[model samples]
Target: MQVHNRRATLTGTVDSWLDRQQAAQEAHEAGAREVNNHLHLLHMALPAATAQ
Candidate 1:
């Protein structure tokens, strides 16, 4: 009984930890996408300059 209870607790904690990690990864990816989009727009808006 005690072993089962311990296993259940550990499983719950692991599930919660994985959930948080997934959320963090998703947020980081979203931020990176936004930053990339901004940089692309900036480059597009700049006039082409010839190097001497």
Candidate 2:
């Protein structure tokens, strides 16, 4: 019974860690996408600025 309880505790900890890891990865990807979009807009504006 003690071993079973320990196993259950360990599983819960691991599951929590995995959930956090997934959340972090998703946030990082979203930030990267936003940065890329900003860069693309800047890139598009450069030609107009140079023409002026």
Candidate 3:
């Protein structure tokens, strides 16, 4: 994460959209006036489930 002029810039990947929103929320809570969320969502395939 990079912080300059009360703006927080987030970089890297997140598993879900919720995580991305949470990151920005945390930044705002930490006194960031502006947030530049450059987080990319990692699209990972889920494993197949076995039949019962």
**TM agreement with the true structure for every prediction:** 0.31, 0.31, 0.81
Query: Candidate 1, residue 17: CA error in Å?
Result: 0.3
Task: Sort by lDDT, best first.
Answer: 3, 1, 2
The list of candidate 2 runs beyond 4 A from truth reads 1-15, 32-52
- Whole-model Cα lDDT of every candidate shown, in order: 0.32, 0.30, 0.96
**Clash pairs of candidate 1?**
none
Model 1 agreement with the true structure over 1-52: per-residue lDDT tens digits: 0123222111122234445455445545544321111111112235689899
Q: How many clashing pairs in candidate 2?
A: 0
- lDDT winner among the candidates? 3
Error of 2 at 12 (Å): 16
The sequence of per-residue lDDT tens digits that candidate 3 reaches over residues 1-52 is: 9999999999999999899999999999999999999999998667999899
Off by over 4 Å in 3: 44-52
- Candidate maximizing TM-score: 3
Tens digits of per-residue lDDT for model 2, 8-28: 111122234445455445545
User: In candidate 2, residue 17 scores what lDDT?
Assistant: 42
Q: Who is ahead in TM-score, 1 or 3?
A: 3
